[model samples]
Target: MTISIAETAETIDTPVLPTTETAKPANVKEVLAFLVSQYPLCFAQDEHIKPLKVGIFQDIAQRLGDDSQISKTQLRQALRVYTSSWRYLDATKEGVSRVDIDGQPAEVIDAQQAEHAAKLLAESKQKAAEKRKARMQEQRAKQPVKAPVAPSDKKRPNKTLVKGSKPVKAAPKAVVPAAKETIATVAPALLTLEPAMLAVGNKVLVKLGQTPMPATIQEVSLPDVTVQLGSGMVIKTRQDSLYQA
Candidate 1:
């Protein structure tokens, strides 16, 4: 096929940049930044790096073409040089470990390093648990243990007058009137009394003379009958106004 003149001209005019190319970081600072951004948890966990494990710093520096500018030994030394500047590498035993980018456990550090770190972590936790147990035991020891009170030793209630305090006299039982005289008194206005008498949270009931009314102790006052009847009717009156069932 004959190539078009416009296509040939366009191809010749446009010199495309090579795609198989890698850019190097400007300096060591840039290399450090890139590494930290890429692998934040490089030196985390028990503050120790494991043997035979790919260190976080080296992997990151190599990926960004910065490793060529520095020697492997030098790079390793720089990474091992722990300082506050490397905030991303803050070691913490409280941190949780999951799979890293390589699908391996994050805390899967050098075997020797991990063994030592694990031992330290276990010792700290053991000390804390022991402290808590000791504190609990101390509290239990300080508590007053009540002996079982025998039924025979229990003091029986006596009906005797005290030297100074007045005796608690029993209330007189309410007299029951004749059945023929007992009758329900009709109310004129159930809501005529003050709402304060039937305040919320108080229990009360409504009665008509000796006859038992369909009522419930929905609310009451200090000396008043403010009741919401079982039939949903609200009434307010004096405690002496309604007779008990």
Candidate 2:
């Protein structure tokens, strides 16, 4: 029996279409494993590593696009967390959080170098302490020691003569005038010599309270004079308070 072209076409069966399985998103551990496998040189056991080139996240995203359902943004965030973990591990192992690799910044564990640096720091501190102690001792040696002051003796009161007691008459002796008395009698001559004797750097008597103490003339300005006492004390007073010694 002869069949039309349309009827013959209807008798043919339709071809079956193939189904595609959805991609699964990669977890952080899987991503880390991929990274380690892809760049074996950048990873070490119990050590940290960093990507040398920039845009590493973009490269990884593109490489994992077919197998992973994770977006580039998600992958980048995961890498950040992973990098932080590496830094923390590095700090604990090496005593430093970062290092340099192939002239690029990275993190690593280098126990030997860290220990050496610690040793050097301790030695420097010890040497500084020793120098400071020696300097303090030298300063103490240069300082002058002060002597303790002694207490002054007080004068005892004279005994009063009893009433109705006859006072003893003392024998009178002839008075002889000394050379000093004769010189003192000439006031005009003494006045001219006194001014010449009172000058800076000369020893003078400074009246303090009822007593006159020895002092050196530091300054001889008009109306006032500065003197240094024997106790190393300096004072300023009126010129009249000073006398030639």
> What C-alpha lDDT values do all the predictions have?
0.46, 0.54
lDDT of 2: 0.54
Best by TM-score: 2
The residue pairs in collision within model 2 are: none
lDDT of 2 by residue, 1-245 (tens): 22222121112111111123343334444444444544455432233443333455665666666656656655665455444342322333453444222234455536875565455445545665687799899999999988988876987645556799887555687697765643333332111216665688998888898567788989878678889999999999877777766
Q: Per-prediction TM-score, please?
A: 0.22, 0.25
Predicted candidate 1, C-alpha RMSD:
26.5
lDDT of 1 by residue, 1-245 (tens): 22222122122222232233344444333334433445455422222422223455555455646436444544453344322121212232233353343435655434554455456545545665687799899999999999998679768675767799987978798998867965557754443324444455444335566544645545456576566666777787676554332
Model 1 TM: 0.22
